[model samples]
Target: MAVAPLLVFMGAAFGLPAIAIATGAFTTSADAPGGVRWTLSNLTTSVHGAYLTALWGSVRLSALSALLATVLGVPLAQAVVTSGSRALRDAVMSASGVLANFGGVPLAFAFVATLGNAGVLTTRLHLAARGWSLYSFWGLVVVYLYFLLPLMVLTIAPALEGLRAGWREAARNNGATSWQFWRHVALPVLAPSLLGGYVLLFGSAFAAYATAAAMVGSSVPLLTSQIADALSGNVLVGQGNVALALSVDMVVVAGAVMAVYVPLQRRSARWLA
Candidate 1:
C-alpha cells in the first residue's frame, strides 16, 4: 500500500511506453482497408540489411569496451581496496562517480579538441602522422573507456572491500601463496561481480547515443545512431515505426543483459556478504 504511488508512477512512466513500443513494432501506420494492420514486417526488417550491421556494430563496441574496462579496472580496484589511505580511496570513489556520469556532448567535444585532426594532442604529439584518428571505431573505444573504466572501478570496489580478511588468512594457513589464493579462492568469488560489472558497462555503452552522435555520427554505424536516423527520416521518409522496431530490438538486448546481470549481482552479493 505504501508503494502504490510508486507503482502507478512506474506504470505511467515506463509501462505505457513499453506497451506503445511493442505495439508500434508490430502494427502498421493507419491507412488502407482496415487501418493500422498488425504485422511482423517491421521486426523482420529491423534484423536485416543495414539494421543488422548497426546492431552488430553496437554490440561489438560495447563488448570490446566492457572487456577492456573490466581487465584494467579489477587490478585498480584491488589496489585501492588494499591501500591503507582512506582519503585516497574516498577521492578515487568520488572521482569515479563524477567521471562515470561524464558523457554526451561535452565529453565528445573534449575528445575532438584533444584527439581530433589538427587538434591539441594530435599536433603536439604528431598523432596524425601515426595514423590516429579520433573519428574511428578504436578512437570511440578509447573515449568510451574514459568513462567505462571509472564505472568499473566503482562497481567492483565494494565487492573487493567485502572480501573477508579471514578467508585470506585461512588460505595462508593452508600454505597458499598470494597468487595461489587469488587463483583458487578470490577469482572464483569475484567472478560474478566482475561479470556483472562488465554487463553494466556493456549496457551503458550500448545505449549511449549522444556521445556517439556528436563524435562519429553515422561513420561508425551504431544502433542508437541508426535509430535516430530512422526516427528523423534521414534514411527515408515515414520510418518512425521502423525506428520503434529498432528501439524494440535495443530494448530486447538491454533486457537480456539485465537478465544476466541481476542474477550475477545477486550471487556476488551473497558471496560478498
Candidate 2:
C-alpha cells in the first residue's frame, strides 16, 4: 500500500507513454483500411539518410561531451573531497546541484548572451572575425560542458570521498611517492566509478533536446531534434511514426549505456564494501 501511488504514477507517466511509442512505431497509419497492421517501414525509414546522420551526430556529441566532463571532473571532485574548508566544499556542491539541473531553453539563451554573434565577449574579442561561431559543433561542446561538468562532479564526489585516507598513509609508509600512490592504488579503485560516471553523462547528453534545439535550431543534426522535426512534420508530412521509431532507438542506446554502467557500478561497490 505504501508504494501503490508511486506505482500508479509510474504506470501513467512512463509505462503508458512508452507503450504508446512502441506500439505507434510499429503500427500502420490510421488511413490504412485494416484496423491496425504492424509494419517495419517506420523503423526502416528512421535508419537512413538524414535520420542516420542525426543519430551518428548525437552519438559523437554525447561521447565527446562526456569524455571532456570526465577528464575535468575527476580532478575537481578530488579537490573538493580533499579540501579542508567545509564552507568551500559546501558552496561548490550546492552550486553543482543547481547547475546540473539547469538546462533546456534557458541554458541556450544564457550561452547566446555570452557567446552569440553580438554577445559581449564575442563582440569584445572579435570572435566573428576570427571565424568563431556559437552555432557550430564546438560551440555546442562548450555549452554542453557547462552542465556536464557539474553532473560529473556530483556523480564522482561520493566516490572520491570513499577513498580511505589510511590507504594513502600506507602507501607513503611503504615508500610510495604521490604519483606512485595514485597510479597504483587510487586510479585502480576509481576506475569503475569514472567509467560509470562517463556512461551516465553520455546518456544525459544523448537525451538532451531543448538546449541544442534553441541554440542551433535544426542546423545541427541531432537525434532529439530530428525526432521533434519528424513529430512536427516540419520536413515531411506524417512522420510521427518515424519519430516513434527514433525514440525506440534512443531507448535502446540508453539501455546499452546502462548495461555497461551497471556492471561498473557493481564493481565499484565491491571496492567500497
Candidate 3:
C-alpha cells in the first residue's frame, strides 16, 4: 500500500510501453485482416543484413567503451577513497552523480562545439590536422567515456571505501609492493564490484540514442539510431514495427546483462557491507 504510487508509475510508464512494443513486434500492422496477425517476420528482419550490422556496431562500441571505463575508473575510485580528504571525496562524488545522468542532444552538442571539425579546440590544438574527427567511431567512444567513467567511479567507490585499512598494512608488513597488493589481494576481493561496474556501464552505453544520433547521424550505424530511423519513417514506411522489434532485441540484451550484473552486485554488496 505504501508503494502504490511507485507501482502505479511503473505500470503506466514501463508496463504499458512494454506491452505495446511486444504487441507491435510480433503482429502485423493495423491493416491486417481482423486487425493484426502473429508473425516472426519483424523479429527475423531485426536480426539480418543492415539491422545485424547495426546491432554488432552497438555491441562493439558499448563493449569497448565500458571496458576502457572500467580499466580507468577503478583507479579513480581508489584515489578518491584514499585521498584522506572528506571534502574532496564528497565533491568528486557529487560531480560524478550529476555527470552520470547527463546525456542526450545537449551532450552531443557540447562535444561537437568543442571537438567537431570547426570546433574551437580543434582549430587551436590542430586536432583536425592530426587526424581527429568528433563524428567518427573512436570519437563517440571518447564522448561516451565522459559520462561512463564518472558512473564507474560512483558504482565502485563504495566498494573501495569499504576496503579495510588493515589489509594494506598486512600487505606492507609482508613486503607486498603496491602493484603486488592490487594484483593479488585488492583485485581478488574487488573482482565482483569491478565486473558489476563494467556491466552497468555496458548497459548505459548500449541503450544510448540521442547522443549518438545527434553526433554522428547514420554515419555510425548504431542500433538505437536505426530504431529511431525506422520509427520515424526515415526508412521504408511501415518499418515502425521493425523498430519495435529492434527495441525488443535491445531489451533482451539488457535483460541478459542485468541477469549477470544483479548477482555480481549482490555479492559485492555482501562483501562491502
TM for every model, in the order presented, reads: 0.97, 0.97, 0.96
Q: Report the C-alpha lDDT of model 2 over 124-219, residue by residue, as the tens digit.
A: 999999999999889999999999999999999988988899999999999999999999999999999999999999999999999999999889
Model 1 TM-score, 2 decimals: 0.97
Clashes of each: 0, 0, 0
Better of 2 and 3 by lDDT: 2
Highest-lDDT candidate: 1
Clashes of 1: 0
Which stretches of candidate 1 lie above 4 Å from their native place?
31-34
Residue 262 displacement in candidate 3 (angstroms)? 0.6
RMSD of model 1, in Å? 1.2
Candidate number that wins on lDDT, 1 or 3: 1
Candidate 2: residue 4 lDDT (0-100): 100
Candidate 3 clashes: the total is: 0
Please give the CA lDDT of all the candidate structures.
0.95, 0.94, 0.94
RMSD of each: 1.2, 1.2, 1.3
* lDDT digits (tens) for residues 1-273 of candidate 1: 999999999999999999999999899877435779899988999999999999999999999999999999999988998999999999999999999999999999999999999789999999999989999999999999999999999999999999999999999999999999999999999999999999999999999999999999999989999999988889887777888999999999999999999999999999998
